[model samples]
Target: MFKPLWVRSLFIAFTALFLAAPLMAEDVNLSERAPSFWKAEGQDNTVWLFGSVHVLTEDHYPLADKVEEAFEQSAYLVVETDVVNVDPQAQQQLMINAGMLRDGQTLEDVLGEARWERARSLAADNGYDLEQMAMLRPWLIALVLSVTELERMGYTAAHGVETYFLERAEREQKSIVELETLQFQISLFSDMDRDTEVAFLMQTLEEIQDLEAQMEMLVAAWESGELDKLEETMLADFADYPEVYERVVTRRNHNWMNDLTRFLDEGQQDYFVAVGALHMVGEEGVINLLREAGYRVERQ
Candidate 1:
């Protein structure tokens, strides 16, 4: 279970981080400390790319000066999605609409006997009731359980990096754009293959007890800004779950590359593009794609 924990860590780091959290920040160094920041220069424009952790803690801010500088220099801020203006209640209803099962199917029916019992047992151990999760689709159940585990391990969506910046953008009246939509992000899970979704849920359950240790390593690796270590611990682990990797990371990276290049070529203003750190690393990442397209992308 823990053997593939790093792969799951990357999954959580990339997608779950984008899920909105409460806006919160605490005093921290003002020095340059963003995990990975890059400047992609086009013939007529520039876009600063910063790899963002979706959820973090109060202690992870005040971000590095360079990140702030880039934001100041840019005319627009881009995120995977703009969660800042979404209504929480509307979002909840949207989730309920997408996360429930049809034909009176239950989570147990979806997970089957062994995996259902495994999940129920884990729930009991963590003081949760699987009965409460009965109507959730498997992917939703996985997200619910994983988020609970992450919370137990001292992580909160409210402390995520994206929430922090979105608040700033609103306060400053800076333009904010999205690479995708909230509906599109939600569909990523809602549309997952049944077996792969179950495997993901099972993998998440198996890693519940180890999440703290895994995230500790993950945070450290992220903070160090070492692309190789980040790639190894995050992206490389996904090799075992090829379909999950392709759908969640690879495909999105490719799509975002097109959006990124277009922004460089067509946008009238410099932009600050923030996405999950995972999308900025490895061979298929946006960074490499831009570099291959002949843009001068350098770490800032």
Candidate 2:
């Protein structure tokens, strides 16, 4: 049997929360982005890799002192995307164009009756109609549902780590670079099959009730700088969605690894690269990849 949508939603929620907690506090004595930063001998630049959560609440405040210090010392700030200057209207247009299915491809046609009804009922509770969302792909629906739930829970992208740092970078007159484009990220969702999309949504919805507990554990692990624990949780949650893992984590990690090396070799300028925390964990994580490439990675 496939997992419920709520369960999958909870996993996504927990994952987002886990990545965001590191940016909430401003304690100078504590380390925030660990196993995320790497130092290279005989190189004039320092590379600070930070894992970020995409949404956050007011309760998650005062980013860790180390993160702030890293930002202050760095000359450039790198993010997954340059959302700071992105046009909202254009973004919405992109999402709608990418998420909605072609004419005649309805959710019912893809999801069938039993699951479709459940999905409809869940959407109704959130002020959306099933029929209206029927043309949207499953991954798109998953994103909409996840964002809606986080918003209801008082988390917003406006308060997220990436946005916060982007804002800071702009104010400090620091140059900002993106590892990927929003369109590229959106394309990842477009490539998912209907079944995987439905399964992802169903699993997310089933985990809604346990989001708080999961968040607590994720935050604790991240704060403790336990990369292995973080990697384990991600691997388990993402096992059902290999495509997502490949698109969002693995492939991107490799791309960034190449970019990091190039940046060090060519510019010799210090860069603060902040990406989703999940990318920095696991065997193929950017940390290990960098280490394998002969760069020294440290937890501080």
Q: Pick the candidate with the highest lDDT.
A: 1
In the range 1-300, model 1's lDDT, one tens digit per residue, is 212322343333456433112222334343746578899887688899988777666766677888888888888889888776899998998889998999999988888898789888987886778899898887777777767666665566667777788888888888898988888878877887787677766776676677666676666667656667777877656667767667777788898887888988898789898788888888888899889888899998
Candidate 1 local lDDT, residue 226: 65
List where candidate 2 sits over 4 angstroms from the true fold. 1-42, 124-128
Top candidate when judged by TM-score against the true structure: 1
lDDT of each: 0.74, 0.67
All-Cα superposition RMSD per candidate = 3.9, 4.0
Runs of candidate 1 with Cα error greater than 4 angstroms are: 1-13, 17-30
Per-candidate TM equals 0.90, 0.85
